[model samples]
Target: MMQATQKQDFTTTFSVDRNPREAFEAITNVRGWWSQEVEGVTDQVGGEFDHHYKDVHRCRIRVTELVPGRKVAWLVLDNFFNFIEDQAEWKGTEVVFEISEKDGGAEVRFTHVGLVPQYECYDVCTNAWNGYLGGSLRNLINTGQGQPNPKEGGNAPAHQDAATVLRARRTP
Candidate 1:
């Protein structure tokens, strides 16, 4: 029997007292909210950056679209999630942030394209993103400095290769 596949992407929207430009700037500052371990440029189109979350997650993303005070999009070039069955599940995803003026403030919408519910990491990833976007990122837009994840270094043991952690997951 053929079953219909459902499409589900994580999205969150909120309005802030700041202007669209401020919201845009905050979204571009990936390290400020998403991760402190980001490397490379993230503010310009075609620029690339790497985000590492301890040893559990790592991804290289390129800024594919950036419209000042309006929209920004990132293409995930490569990814590895140690806890997931498909370590490279997020490799081709797109993370998008759109900002618009509304009610004398800025309305920000964030979407993680391809992060469907069928993916193994969807629940955990979505919850983490809620804290990052709704809580941390929003705090940065309202006040200075976001509550980013602590720099706790890598989680893999010193004797093990980081890539090996992905292969060590139990088979279903």
Candidate 2:
């Protein structure tokens, strides 16, 4: 087990005024808040999807788990990064999302299970995530609109359709 003081996987949580079901719906709609460039199936377990941010990053995702209004998770089947030495750093990682009721609203907790501080992408990834979840995802749940990547002709690595991201195991 990991000690409390030890560094943990990337995690962030945000609250929305909407109910749990609304939060769930907004989250499952990947194209609404993440990016319009997303391709493939979302909102179902065992679905496959692909997301790319121009050519800087691309990944194939397999939806491994989902629980309506409660949780969702994804397994990274393949990964590529133009700026990283480890082209497969995200391969096999699991992305997880958890939803719970709070103050009559909903709170979404996101975790990238394998994205630890030691990895090169940690800082950049976490920063982007803060913006996506705290800003875009939150807005989507609240106002029915989100600032997802606008079919970028290649911008910061966003728009992958994994629904929920929870990094899994790291391979050397």
Candidate 3:
């Protein structure tokens, strides 16, 4: 059996026992599940936001698409990762969230549109996204409380799932 191997973007999906509107709202609440410091606008189209996690990873995201109860997309304008050699690996990528009605509830699909396995950040990033989407984000939609990184001094490095990435990399 010849198995075809092809690289694909990183993506994850989860179902919530809520309406599409609720799921969409939870997805827009970036500060809720992503667990970082966000500045500027996140829910408005054409808006820009910057999120940083203890100098480990920082990115400027511009909201390129916002569809109520349907979808939201953000384009990565700039990115910095202290762990990987290519600090700009996330630049020019797109973070997209799609919400659709399913089984009397809603399903949210998250896709990091250019984050292929070829990038160094793929493994660590995939783990983080899985935690964010499957655990935190899903909790927020269901219970109204997402375990976000608080502003107070706790949870060092901010990114709950990716803190080790910083210490694992060598500083040149």
Candidate 4:
């Protein structure tokens, strides 16, 4: 007998003083909170964009669904993570954002479908999302600008090969 696999998407939700429309707009402005190294379009349905985190990670995302002032979803066409055994783990995954009215304000819910805890990059990836969705993205909804990753250089360590990253992860 085969057991069914449990769903383990990573999700984060936050409330903002803004309205649903404002929250929806902020979510579509991916570069404002996701990464400044993004390329191509992001605010329209059927649009495609590429997000890069230096040489560490890169993903091609296509907007698959959009509902004004309500929801948005992106399909991951391709993905590459220099630090993971399965570089394309995020491929075919869906990144979704749901907006609704709550407490006379807006409530935003972000989910990364197919990002199960069983994946090797789950912890690191989810932690990063916590910062992006829960912190940076949330800030963007409240303010005009977001605290995105440094554009050129910052305290981030230089990129390392996959083997090196694996070794570092295993180290005490």
Identify the superior model by lDDT, candidate 2 or candidate 4. 4
Clashing pairs in 4: none
Off by over 4 Å in 2: 1-7, 153-172
User: Cα RMSD (Å) per model?
Assistant: 6.6, 6.9, 4.3, 4.8
Q: Residues 120-148, candidate 1: write the lDDT tens digits.
A: 87766776787788888888998967777
Candidate 3: C-alpha lDDT: 0.82
- TM-score against truth, every candidate: 0.84, 0.84, 0.89, 0.87
Which window of 10 residues has the lowest lDDT sum in candidate 1? 154-163
Q: lDDT value for candidate 4?
A: 0.81
Q: Between candidates 3 and 4, name the one with more favorable TM-score.
A: 3
Highest lDDT: which candidate? Answer: 3
Q: What is the lDDT of residue 165 in candidate 4?
A: 59
Give each model's clash number.
0, 10, 0, 0
lDDT tens digits, residue span 114-137, model 4: 899989888778877887777778
Question: By how many angstroms RMSD does model 3 differ from the true structure?
Answer: 4.3
Task: Report the lDDT tens digits of candidate 3 across residue range 1-172.
Answer: 1122265888888899999999989888999877558888999999999887766678899999988999999999999876788877799988888899999999998889889999988887887778778888899999998876666476643335464744555544
Write the residue-wise lDDT of candidate 2 on 1-172 in tens digits. 2223355888888899999899989988888888788899888999999887765568898888888888888998998865567766788888888999999999998988787898877765777778888888899999999988878664433433222232222322
Name the best candidate (by TM-score): 3
